[model samples]
Target chain A: MLLKTTLIRLLTTAVTLFGVAVVVFVLVRVAPGNPIAMMLPPGATEADIAALEALYGFDKSLPEQFVIWLGGVLQGDFGTSITLRRPVDELVLSRLPATLELSIMALVIAVALGTAIAVIGARRRGTATEVGLDLSSGAVLSVPDFLWGLVFVLLFGVLWPVLSISGRIDPQIEVDFTSNFYTFEGLLRGRLDVVQSTLSHMLMPALALALPLAAMIAQLLKQNLKEVLLQDYTTLARVRGFSETSVILREALRNALLPTLTLVGVQFTFLIGGTVIVERIFSYEGLGNMAIDAVINRDLPLIQGIVLLFAALFIVINLLVDLSYTLLNPRLRHG
Target chain B: MTGSQTHPNTLDVMQLNIALPNGHRLLRDVSLSLRPGEVRVLVGESGAGKSMIGKAVLGILPQNLKVTEGEILLEGQHLNAMTPWTRRKTVAQSAALIPQDPLTALNPARRIGPQITDPLVRIHGWSRTKARETALALLDRVHIRDPKRVMESYPHELSGGMRQRVLIAAAFAPSPRLIVADEPTTALDVTVQKQILRLIRELQQETATAVLFVTHDMGVVAKVSQQVTVLFAGKVMEDAPTERIFTDPRHPYTRALIAATPSYADLDRPFSPVPQALIAELQDDIVRDDARHQGGAR
Candidate 1:
């Protein structure tokens, strides 16, 4: 049953990705500016622009160009970045790890902080501590992540000056990485120094992206937990002689987490998308940063590649969420 | 502790008064007792606070509700006099609850094996293997086929009857002196209810455990209890031996409740609800009693 469901999900995901690719291809072409014109110097004649357009296949009819692009895409070729003069696939792959690492760090921070606060808040529902949590979470949730990034930049980067705000790591440190996933590579290679440098640089931007998400998670989970705590099972746990802590942690938390898991999964995709603005603020060398540069230069192939990657991430994450739902809930598992 | 084994009564609840924070009473001077191997069913309508008595005894009352005045003795030990921590420990070690809504009573995310055995190993301090063995044995005693498979299954994997059986097994596993079966069969189908009640009764007799059974169903009281406490708006209107309560009920509320139950044998006898006049009278009496009590306190 599990395999059948997974296979169906994979088929749907492929269809969705293809749909996304086609739409993005048309949409980028429909934009006001031409990629070849954006690429060339203003002093260049129409002849030079025409030659570049023919070479890149932009001079062909729209349908012909789409068919040609689709063929190349089927063969793992996303064409080339019109501005960067590099393969779009290579550019996206290299930058993807950096974004993944940051997003993962932010996700870890958000879940840990969110769950702890929610447990405390829900356990003390009627108290001042719970009230304080509600108020603070409300405040945190009202601000967007990029604004938080700017605030972090001012507070930690300018005032404190304790952590790096620009780039993924300090250029001064030298390390050979087998993979672009710096943090994982650093950990596997037993090079704590590289990991430390990468983390210190990542902390503020990740936290900026994380704080709003954490508050959202806390609020929702707290609400869910309070409802679950009032359930007959939690009362039975108490009557069974389990401690209050265990009653909440053992019986209640898992039930409450089902909904929170879904919310977190949905928000994580947005958190990655949110890195576009946050990355620009931190000047972090991740996919979100590259995406901005591609957009400004009207790098059509790069834009399509990046957008497709983002859409793919969204679909895959949702698939993972569904898989985990089955793992967490027995009825789903059995069915 | 040794003397408690020979104690005449396993549970003693004296003049227990539970009230909401806003001064509205839920249980007004309610009291009952349970001898070993006996079932004392608290029967009432939905708002009659039958379950409140069971909750008060088990220390599972809502956090918002306060025990304004009461004495609950578990095996001759004054539970109210003990510190909160000690009281909780005592309650955990000596009592268990068979809850209403079997569907929600077992944690959905947990396995059946750990749900029953973890308490034994953790709270009762039994060895892990012994707890597991006892759990399996109790599961078998509940007439669940293939106890090992049932233990490995989640609550959602089983039918409502099966979940209730698992709960009965868990309750009886520890051989707790007191088991509060609060409308344990209310959520089940009619066919399943009889089996669950019989299973509970069988386990109670085998363990010689005192059970505080709460139900609104008069039929349940007749089937399960040796003694019946008929409650009206949280006040005990009748306390008598089960046979006497059925054959010669004294309280108007009790008579009305018995009349309300459908007689399966007599198709001609009409089923009637408790008369509104009797309920009004009961509420009026409670109001006067509350006023008198308030005046006395002043």
Candidate 2:
């Protein structure tokens, strides 16, 4: 049963991704702008425009152009970026590490703090502490992440000025990065200084992005935990002489976490997509930051590449969530 | 330690009153005692506070309800007088609950082995190996066909009867002096309920554990309990030896309950529910009693 579901999920993911690629391709073209016009200087002639369009296969019909792009994409080519004159796949891949690092950091922060606060709130349910948590989390959730990023910049960047507010890392920290994943490569090389710089720069933007997501997680998880705590098993655990902490942690938490995981998975996909504005705010050169540049410059291939990567990421994360659901829930596993 | 000459009752609940925050009493002046090796059933219809009594004794009552006036003694220890932590520790060391709704009474994510052994190891300070062995023995004793496999299995893998049996094994594993079997068989099929009741009875007798069995089924009470406490709206309608409860019930509510129970042997007997008039009269009497009690307090 597990194998069958996984095979079906894989097939659906392929179909969904193909649908996304086609939509993105058609939609980007349909928008009122010619990539070649946007690329050339204001004084360029019609001949120059026609030559550029023909060179990039833009002169052909939409279906013919789609076939050409699709055939190139099948063989690891995502076309050349009209703006940077670089391969779109190369540009997206180069920027991927920064986004992944930031997203993973934000998610870790969100899960840890969110789960901790939720546990505290659930344990002290109906007390003043729980009310305070509800109100504070509500307040946190009311604001969008980009606003949080600006506030973070004001508080930690302009005011206190203890941590780095802009960029992936300090240019002064000279370390040989073996791969684009600077933090991982630095850690592997035992160069803590490079890793430290990467983290210090990541902290503010990541937290800004994480705070709202954390609040969302806390609210959903706390509510789930409250309900689970009232289950007969939790009461039975108490009757068995288990401590309140044990009852909550051991019995209630596992039951509560399943629904929270679903929420986290969906929210995580959005969080990655949300990084577009947040990355710009921190001047962090992640895919989302590059995505904005691609849009402004009408870098069609780059935009298509980044959007497709994000779509693939969304599908993969959702698939992972489904797989973990089966793994975590014994009922699903056995059934 | 008096060589069994004079053993203290396993559990003692005196004038236990559980009330909601709005001063609505859920259990009114309830009292009972259970000697070691005794199985006393608290019999009542739904909302009659039968299960509430069991929860009260085990210190697992709902947070919305408070034990306003009560004292519970477990093996002569004054549970009400102790500090909260101490009370919890004392209760944990001696008491267990076999809960209603077997489906929801075991954590679904956990394997049965850890679920059963955790209390033994944590509360009783037994080693993992010893607890595992004891759990295995108890599971086999409950006639679980494959104890080893069931131990590794999650609660969802087991049938309702199987889960209830697993719970019974867990409850008895620690050899707790007091076990509150709160409708353990209520969620099972009819045939399964009988087997579960028999298993509980066998285990209770073998371990000499005092069981406070809560049920609305008169048949279960008759089959399992030596003494019966019949409750109606938190008030005790009758308390007597099981023989007298069956043969010569004094309260009108008790007679109505007995008459309401359908008997397979006498299929011709008309099933009569507790009369509405009697319920109204009982409610009126309870209101007067509550008013008097409040007035006296003032």
Q: Candidate 2 on B246-288: residue-level lDDT in tens?
A: 9999999999999999999999987798999999999999999
DockQ of 2: 0.82
What is the per-residue lDDT of model 2 for residues A1-335, given as tens digits with 9 covering 90 to 100? 87897798889988997898899999999998778887789999999999998998899999998888989999999999988989999899999999999999999999999999999999899999999999999999999999999998999999999989899999998866757898999888898989999999999999988999999999999999999988888888888777787788888888899999999999999899889999999999899999999988888888899999999889888888988998889888655
Question: After TM-score superposition, what is the CA distance of residue B275 in candidate 2 from its true location, in Å?
Answer: 3.6
Task: Work out candidate 2's RMSD over C-alphas.
Answer: 2.2
iRMSD computed for candidate 2: 0.9
TM-score of chain B of each: 0.96, 0.96
Each candidate's fnat, listed in order, reads 0.88, 0.92
What shift in Å separates residue A195 of candidate 1 from its native position after superposition?
0.7
How many Å off is the CA of B279 in candidate 1?
Answer: 3.4
Model 1 C-alpha lDDT per residue in residues B1-298, reported as the tens digit of each score: 1224567478888999989999888888987888877899889889889888888878888889989998999888899999878988899888989989999888888999999999899889999999999999889989999999999998878999999999999988888999999899889999999999988888788788989999988898889889999998889999999999999999888899999998789979876998999888988999999999888879
